[model samples]
Target: EYPDATATDPTIVPFGPQEGESLSNCSTKFLERIRDWCVNKDALPQTVDVIKLLLVERKKAECRVPTHPPKDESTGDVPRAIVEAQQDEIQFPDEESK
Candidate 1:
């Protein structure tokens, strides 16, 4: 456990201000608060992370056009596997038979 409340010592910047293409691009700082929330089962910071986020900002000049999947021929929109998720299902309530 952290002492002196370093975890929440400084409240994180409001969510709206943190909105940016990347953390480095945001005018506000947020990484410290994010780090505070990460820990292992022993309540200790885990050094061995299975996956890590590496957000880096690139100059607009250096950015390249991203490839996208073909859009639906009829709808002219990108196809989503589900209404909400890449792979998800939408459920409807069953109506009672008369």
Candidate 2:
């Protein structure tokens, strides 16, 4: 019965902030923006590169913010170097950015 129930599938949806969860951050929004933009943009690889560069630059720029020190704000966030490495690992279908 359970298998049959799932077999007749209707529309499925992702559960998140819209469904009443505490979801709010730049990273989440950044990923969503990238996904949407890449859908219609040409040269996917170049687009991805631009996104990664923008992300890294943003992090670096924020590091120099005078109001709040980066150390204190990012005590639990991923290390910038690791984040950059992960960005490099990002692979799209065509691998056009290389």
Candidate 3:
């Protein structure tokens, strides 16, 4: 007799390390980049949260999954001020190059 599976079925897909890249090294590099960018931008608490969320989305993209299915890109847990700051930084990145 086969048991009925629930809606939240945990089908595990084992992911091995990418060619020449261990998971630990990849994670370390990812976090270091995030930290450097955040520090350069003088990130607030909300900005940190947004950065983390973005990283998660990027990971999902790498895994060939949908990015943030429930949450829309424009709307997240981050504050409006932080979101605005991030937008401004994107638009005026040259200012930081000087």
Candidate 4:
């Protein structure tokens, strides 16, 4: 028999912008809050983890594209993974700003 489980609800907090405000710092704070709630057994743990993961993934996607393209204007077929991996090893300076 299912008993009434309406006694539980989570308190939501909002983020503020100011000095030292950055995505990394904000994400860490958000995860800590989620951990506090989960450790106290106030909310679902998996949901919080998924949200954290999504924020991290979105940041990665946004950073993957170059803010400035190479000067050659050649859109090569190489996958981003290979380019990123070789970037440091090959030491090719960015041609975009030239």
Candidate 5:
């Protein structure tokens, strides 16, 4: 593609490192060049990776098995919102990866 065409390409945005999927299959040289072009390497937010969240959500999405209360044991049913509130997820990179 020509230089003018590349400049107009929507995929060539500035937020390349904003998500893991954006760099998932990228070449090593392309990765390095993107790193070099970073305007603010130190201003990222303190939050979970978008890719990890998407993966967890995707996994949950695939688990389409509808849950039901046991026929013989339950005296009362817990609300879905309360059960969901008790569950949480987090991810942290190991020491060597940073």
Candidate 6:
């Protein structure tokens, strides 16, 4: 279950601007909130997957920036086992049927 809070609760704050904000700013704030939520012990696999996808997309975008320096050609692909291990660290176990 989610945290219990009433409308008058001061600590139950919104993550970002309420109105007239740019889409990019809103998106960034939303991602930050999701990342924080994903740190909880009960986070679902789907939540972790969303964070991973966001990270990979961000890296790809950074690489595509015109003014950014290029990556060195000498670096090679990450080993499959290492990649799997990293995923395991973040991933949740399969959910049981309700």
Q: In the order shown, what is each candidate's alpha-carbon RMSD?
A: 15.4, 14.6, 17.6, 13.8, 15.4, 16.5
lDDT ranking, high to low: 4, 6, 3, 2, 5, 1
Give the per-residue lDDT of model 6 (tens digit) for 48-83: 686676667555644443342333357865433333
Give the better candidate number (1 or 5) by lDDT. Answer: 5
Cα lDDT of model 3 by residue, 1-98, tens digit: 76545334543213322332334444555566667767888876767686677567556635753223333357755433333333322222233432
Summarize candidate 1's per-residue lDDT along 1-93 as a digit string, tens digits.
545553565543433121112223231233444454553234334423411322222223124312343567999866442222222223222
RMSD of 2: 14.6
TM-score of 1: 0.21
TM-score of each: 0.21, 0.34, 0.33, 0.33, 0.19, 0.31
Tell me how many clashing residue pairs each candidate has.
0, 1, 0, 0, 0, 0
Poorest lDDT segment (10 consecutive residues) of candidate 3: 11-20
Please report, as a residue range, the 10-residue window in candidate 4 with the lowest summed lDDT: 14-23
- Pairs of colliding residues, candidate 3: none
Candidate 5 positional error at 48, Å? 7.2
- Residue-level lDDT for 87 in candidate 3: 37
Model 1 segments more than 4 A misplaced: 1-40, 43-47, 51-66, 79-98
- Top candidate (lDDT): 4
* Top-down TM-score ranking: 2, 3, 4, 6, 1, 5
* Best of the two (5, 6) by lDDT: 6
Q: In model 6, which runs have C-alpha deviations exceeding 4 angstroms?
A: 1-17, 42-44, 48-98
Distance from true location, Cα of 87 in model 2, Å: 22
* Global lDDT of each candidate: 0.33, 0.44, 0.46, 0.49, 0.36, 0.48
Model 6 TM-score is: 0.31
Tell me model 2's lDDT, rounded to 2 decimals.
0.44
Candidate 1, residue 76: the lDDT equals 87
lDDT of 2 by residue, 49-88 (tens): 9577756755664454333213325476543433333343
Whichever of 1 and 6 has more lDDT, that candidate is 6
